[model samples]
Target chain A: MATTENGPGALEPRPAPPKEQRFSLNAIQELEEIASHYPERKAACLPALWIAQREYGGYLTPAAIQEVADRLGMSYAEVEGVATFYTMYNLRPRGRHHLEVCTCLTCAVMGAYDVVHELERALGIEVGGTTRDGEFTLSEVECLDYCGAATVVQVGDRYFTHVTADNVLNLIEELRQSEEYTPVKLADAIVKLHLPGSSQTGGGSRTGEQIRNNELY
Target chain B: MGIRNLLFEHRDVENIQDIAVYEKHGGYRGLKKAVKMERSAVIEEIKTSGLRGRGGAGFPTGIKWSGIPQNDDKPHYIICNADEGEPGTYKDRELMLKLPHLLVEGMIIAGYALRGTAGYIYIRGEYVEPAWQVRKAIDQAYRAGYLGKNILGVKGFNFDLYIHMGAGSYECGEESALMSSLMGERGQPRLKFPHAPYPTVEGVWKSPTLINNVETFCAAAKILDMGGAEYARLGTERSKGTKIFSVSGHVARPANYEVEMGTPLMELIEAAGGVVGGALKAVIPGGSSVQIVRAEDCPRVNLDYESCQQNGTLLGSGGFMVFNDRTDIVLLMKRTAEFYMHESCGKCTPCREGTRWIYKILDRITSGGGQPGDVELLLDICSQIDGRSYCGLGDAAAWPIVGAIKAFREEFDYWIAHKRSPVGPGHVPPTPEVVNPLLTLVPA
Candidate 1:
């Protein structure tokens, strides 16, 4: 039978979801601060949902969605709808390191197809499957917004571009074993710090060398 | 043509987001001049410069700005479409990450032109570093009197700007979709054409709005600084000024390069340190959505709006992605189909279902399944989804698939005929009977 937990027919005040119970005081403060950025509290739906997902361990659970709704003054349905919309937000639990490999046109043409296959083979899991050891989850994503470095494989927030079957495993091993992230050559460049004075846009400079060197302070 | 490093210059400088470093390289010059110039004068100057929208549409920026109702009682809003979610496009990322002031100064000028009391730069959520840089620049602008009360210390010239990060949604890059997201709604494209209440006429709480791409606004700042007529002299008749192309894929150096609009596409490829390994076979002159130009026809393709359009492609977002002869065309087509399907937003039935349908068929072909008439079916499906969807996302999904099939039907057919996966090192035919549940086109 369809219950009020899944429907609007229930009468009692809905119990707090698991995420709400697990929500740290700090996360609530962060959500409140983020809510203030929008003119309407509802406008913080995306940000609020993101916080809930992060706190709940890299995925959005039913509890997390309900918690967001309660905090944002939204219905359970409204919160659920936005949370499930974007590909970035995980609806289910992910592995410790969620690897999102870009399979868009550029990345695919540059052999991202092989990259996905290699990841699947090495991890012994298909795309969208979690590894048996619970260390990794592989997904074929759209874009990491860095097309120049095609075939971007994002491990959590870190992006590994120009990945191939050869070096991608080295990268995974590095991520698994290393203390600090020591990237393969291409990925190393992707994480290069965007220092002062040098920027991609400004001052009619296309060679990107106009402000190449400037005082740090 | 040599590198015309206009906006892309000084991208790597340390502390590039600092107001002082930005000012060192003639930053805020356009905003300073814009404060002096009358509002209409700023709009008119942009019009004369012939700056077109950089966010794939190639719409004229001046004409779009002129559409805002100045006498309306409703508050006007100026939105910067920094929510760049296109698969192969990252020029906007380069701009926001490096030159925060360029976008901020551009927003101030555009805000002045549109007479918008408040402004918002709707950036995508995944851009953690860019958002931090943008907020830093906005804070710097407020302190320098470029934003907030009395911009540039002029009396009654109060203006405020804020950066709003979007939760990852590709459709949010659409103008109406962006507005919907900004208003705390689902990022779905509002039906405007053949309907009333365009964004310029009524947007963001039913008020007049002037929304533009990050690159377009940045260009506007430059056009104002340089004489409009002089800026007009840079490119072809229809398209003017330099365009930033984020060249990646099979290239030695995949970086963002801004070139004059009419530069040949091959030159842009060379500027990206040329294609890696074998000879160049195909090129997506714009981002992934536009029609793909085969290698032979690529040289004739100019890096401008009309020229690319004439050549059966587009200068979309200038996200130039190259592929060498060794690359698999069919796999590329499949991957492209997968992107559109995932990002369809599920608002329009045709886009939602049609992209899925195409992806299903492409999966079938790539999974070593063959049908005699699959290519025709793919093209037919594209026709159904192209103009019928509610928004550009569907059209974008349709174009590249149709273009790929039209350009390289043989490669697709080979995969089907031989039941081979064109991916791996050699002609690796599927040794295992891999059944994709989505592929259901076999004539049992």
Candidate 2:
């Protein structure tokens, strides 16, 4: 079946994991805290996937899914199914500064097409393809609930609203340089990576240890 | 008669999320007032206020609370539907980002009324800032004694709220799907039998749960403070209270506007700083799922449920997507259909296949391969998908094609006749300046 080249990389099969590793101590600690909030262990599925997406660079890997499944006492297929069902859980890899342009009704009409086209032209790839420098991958997604900010371009955790085609290139360069992301990481900037609950109660848990950043996951 | 701004009253005020600032401006006053009131009285107030769910389905909020069985053995849950993913909607995002306490306060009151011990704000993953702000507000509320084991030192009334993130399934905005996603499963909507329990009766963990919109919860708190009867006086007969419309696209000033219900459709557009280039082509009165009406026929339309329904469109999630004369109807319909097609959970056959088929046909026609009978086929497919699929999404997949063809069949037919849209590429418009904070301008 020929997939429409509309949204970048939707129909393409997700890449297989290169290797496997257990969740880091901090990730386990965070997952345990999140798991405590729910009545069932499975309810922590989205949160676990979020941690994996952050720990791994911008995508989920099969190994990470298995680790999450193991932690939640669910089958790999079950976790994978839950992970793949969500659009935010990227099965394949995304670039360093993953950029998504909202191309739904509001943004599409409000210059989203132009934004995507410009991003593609600037990056020298179509919507689904990634840049050779591994800096950006442009994809058009559904609404982000920021419709008023038409042509809403989401990069990591930041939403750059109302970006036109004319300024998108500059916007990309700016976003690539944009700092501070979500999905709690291990570092001195632990405030950005502070897991909910009492992981930072003592003010001494800033181990400055980075989570293993597997590029290919 | 005029714009009514309740939810967005302090939208532009800095540090509104800070508990001190919010309370100083009467933030938790509703929660404080409701806490001392009897549990039944809180529910009674919401019932009297006539506040309907601001989520797509205009279900009465007070009546929804009345459905939950209080003495049920299982503990009750209160889920805040913060996953505002409907195309052309962003009002909840602002409410959560700017005024997070309103949601927290609303949840506390609603949970207290239903005897719900736990609450969750199921926010969409794409909403990075709103979610963070909400989490911070939750912490603030906990520290301020507005939440937790004994709020205001009131015993036997325990309500704990947590913020959860959804990866990205637009269907999760639906209560059942949201529960499924919450319980670590694929977010698919369950079939509802008449006698069978709803989320309020048999929801997550098979317990009675109440899910309300961010705006609904905020309005609940506001209703409690303003007194139910006073709140009921606003809006039309059925649609009460001021609604926050996320006005976007083809407008000089596209932003969130809170207007009294039953405001004329043209008036809301004017409130959003009027049409760009001083011309209007069409208006999607609601979100993408509702009908798309032409600008020529919009004056008869009002920003209420009854008026939109009378005009052959429903005021479903006031995500107003306005289009100007420079826009292309074919492309809009195509994109709208394409969205539902992509978001379909594939649980049902009709919607799963029908949406894609309709999109492909539109794709062919819009790309200049349109043959005769394509429009009829699209309409036929839309009818098949509508009312046939299990959930509202399946029915929603039909609206884009049905509404577009209904209002602008000739324009769609024009694409088929010409084998291409008259409005083509290289005609990308400029972005309207997005105001950082959507506040109504008060002339000094």
Candidate 3:
């Protein structure tokens, strides 16, 4: 296949890991279960690729995605197309903490632009740029379905809604102090980085933790 | 109650797509039974089943099918609304994945009942797996004489099925929009005048067309197989048979579940292993479009269409999204409104401008800049949007915000009066003004 100027990644491929770590038992188990939904194992290619990308930090390399396609009994081209289509799946290497700021229509209207700009400045990297420390990567995505809390940003699995420019500094400070700042689960990371001056329950029980704390009302 | 998992049971296996497996499991029994009966009898059987459309609208399926012109020389068409664009709803995809032949069987029976020759399943673009399964099933049906010329040995009755893929657009879920898309045009909905005698009489290239959801047709097939009265016995009088609900969000188990029509809301949450790591705060009863219910009030409701209607909500597409205390309801509504606005086809000014305006107003309010009279302003915009737009999309776009305001007035008031969200800070509350909250202005 000829690589056209408009090809998916005009940039050169990033260097691969010394020896690709084989997929862990848990990752394979998860992939197998998701693949069980369809009559064919190949149907789970996209979701399996997503899980694989998370396991290898934030970005997904062509080699990694192809590995997923192979494991799920699909062609590499099919997995590549799905990876490029969705903005949520990162195709390149990102920082340790891949904080996605939703800049979709709702978030945009709710001051997400300000949060994005502020976060980028605080992290000392551009929107799609990774930090020198390789600790954080900021990117803008479409809807994450958290429209009610406009200006929502998710570091790993956790989301911080009602986010503001002033609150970005405190979020960074929290990330720096905590040894458990590693964002393995996106939802859990969002719950951990509470903005300063927020309600003691942090966003007043909007955290999944609060839901578990019986502060449901 | 038999609670027959006929459609959903045994989802995994190689080449269930093969006709042999389908036949061995009593698959075409309904079609064979219907083959011997008159078309009118088939329609009557569906009518007696009390089955309703599963494509969000909940209209009676048999009544809609019966309204079509039977004697017309023009070709009557049957369309399956597999464009499952409603967020949090994936039951149609699940059905097509689990039992593709059931849909084919139902469509064949329906094609025969309506005196139709062709049918199309307008599948969503994102559903790669389900679409492939349906296409394979259609092919198998052709090979087995279940589709194409003279379906299943019923000579001289030619009915063909085609699979049309939609390009990731939610608007195509609308009937007129779907018809336009099938004709290869941009999917802006056409204006419909009330008392026009439902689209079954005039649809899809202006010939009588019957559009039913994938699950709805499968339910119809179940009715034919189980006997109409027997199927009707499973649900409330107004809404019969089992309903497939796509449960997502803060549930411990976020999967699709099929339940009898009148099952209580609490039973559903329990089935999904309770809320995921939190106290349940709210429930979006039917996708993100219909009115939301607080967790306290959810126990009083049932899964039937009538119950939803009586409770000022809808049994819409059976997409039940659970939200815990962690979810900000205001932000949730804003996101949903934004989806409707973005997907709006911009055909009518009321819908086009109204959805944008609603998003803008809600955006400003939730962003902590809401004005004191913004509540009235928001209500006014929604009222103008409701019933004034060309298609049901506009009304769908407007309903959630209206219902949310009516049900959660205090939450909106707290945001407006305190310059902060009742739930958290960094929320720019709307401007405070001394406005009365009790003036009830009924929607037009």
Candidate 4:
């Protein structure tokens, strides 16, 4: 990784291209509603990126950042700064599923590395790489704050807890059969959460089975 | 005393996330009681309870509430620091997930007390499920007349609550940084009091703002419901009410245990089904930020603020992580250093550069490149970083390394001299990969 004066691999400023508005009418309305929650429009920068991430399919392209900046009346650089500051916003295109395994203190002690190794061997991709099929991208994350259930693997908005090297393969198989916990779904859920009546619309990553089983609480 | 479930009493109840079940179990009584009383009286009640901030700082809650200028023309804002990013702590996650109404009620009460115009729960982005529960709770509150204009029919008394999710920055857990993040800037912290006004004096959009942890506000609602004096009787003189310790690591039943403040540290371990895999080796009594206590010192330390301080650790965020004998102290500290290094907001010179230096040294030492003066160098760097940054994250990064050295210096020396863990092979924390190729260039 190259360290620029700005920071680690700082986003190079490119000449502004012709603006392409990718946000749907609903996204525009959603951004406005979330912006109205705050005193100023700039406060909507984080949520706008989430909407942009979903609109642009799971990662923030320069164009996606531009779209968010244009929507919230912030500069592209400003919105890009916010997007890059937080770890959740994907700055690059990811696999359909981003398997964020927590290898922090507790999880490390609980054999999180072994799980990472298993995922790597299975997917034939290292921690920071995506599978050839564009199915999964494995990355070691810090604590998801669910240490009670160690070796927590977060796929989109859903948390698969008590995950070990033994059972992780099973989780991978389950994920392959489902489309619920993709990065795009995560962005959609997050975007919907900011809207006032989103709960009624049943947005977020929890599966209907999980919610019916009362697994979320 | 162990497992004193105040906020978590109804946690196990079915559909407790719903507003109706919460009301059936005597929810909104605190807000109903608060609406009848004078605003100062609400502050007075909290003052009598002796509650402190549950968000690691342990600052007095009542004083924080009263700090807001009363009846000021500028609209006051109440912010909940729900960004539960501390590695070993997840109590706030459970609080918001199961008992969303409790937090909602607590925030509404605080709003009424502070004459707040609105409240925001700054949830971390990874906690989408918990955030969804909160979203439902807020919607239910609005429908039930607990949030939004003129709550309970009080004229000119309106407070709106909204959920603001973080894009995933641990530094935003700090109050000033939280405000900065809420205002949609990079999640770097601002200057504190004397350099800048207190958050109560100028926060968010530069209005009088009050920020507190999720557990603190939940306890406030409980204090109002149970009467402040009664709630005061639960914990120690300084640290009042029950504190939720998210006990993780090598425990059989790793879960959040809500125990009275003065409970024995060992008893909480027993409640968590004791240490698993091996004998209890060490305990990071209050999250990874606090000092690591040796097993010999465990009995002497109680889970209160003063007792923990006497034992050379603060009861920080109640993230009690227990480790068994098989755990490697040097490797554990290495991982801890890695967390801080990754999460440092890069705003300050000390934390930004210092955390990376700490991680590199730890990584080197763990990868069999330890030198004699390496331990001392680590300490020196920690000393420089501690209290040098604008926020507590820098100090937090410093404390554990300094504490580990204080308690487990022999482990560092053992790894250096023997080129192996004191605990032998098959130790936890896999050997460090040369993740950063630049590290290969460093003289070892």
Docking quality (DockQ) for each candidate: 0.28, 0.30, 0.02, 0.46
Local error of candidate 4 at residue B257 (angstroms): 0.6
In order, the candidates keep a fraction of the true contacts of 0.42, 0.56, 0.00, 0.66
lDDT of 3 at B349: 92
lDDT of 1 by residue, B127-216 (tens): 655665676678777777787777786676767776666766888998988988887678898888667677888888788888899998
Q: Pick the candidate with the highest DockQ.
A: 4
> Candidate 4 - CAPRI tier?
acceptable
Model 4 clashes, total count: 1
lDDT of 2 by residue, A61-117 (tens): 788887777788988889988987887777777676667787777776677767776
lDDT, each prediction: 0.75, 0.77, 0.69, 0.89
lDDT of 1 by residue, A5-117 (tens): 66565566655455445567876776676565456788777767667666666677788888888888998888777776665567766777778777666765666668877
Alpha-carbon lDDT of model 3:
0.69
Q: What's the CA RMSD for each of the models?
A: 6.1, 8.8, 14.4, 4.3
lDDT of 2 by residue, B139-254 (tens): 77888888888788888788888877887789999788888888889999886756467777788898888999999999998998899999989988988888888898878888
Comparing 2 and 4 on lDDT, the stronger one: 4
> After TM-score superposition, what is the CA distance of residue B115 in candidate 2 from its true location, in Å?
0.6
lDDT of 4 by residue, B142-228 (tens): 999988888999988899999998987889999999999999999999999889999999998989999999999999999999999
Off by over 4 Å in 1: A1-33, A55-57, A177-217, B12-14, B416-418, B421-444
Residue B17 Cα positional deviation in candidate 4, in Å, after optimal superposition:
1.0
lDDT of 3 at A90: 60
lDDT-based ranking, best first?
Answer: 4, 2, 1, 3
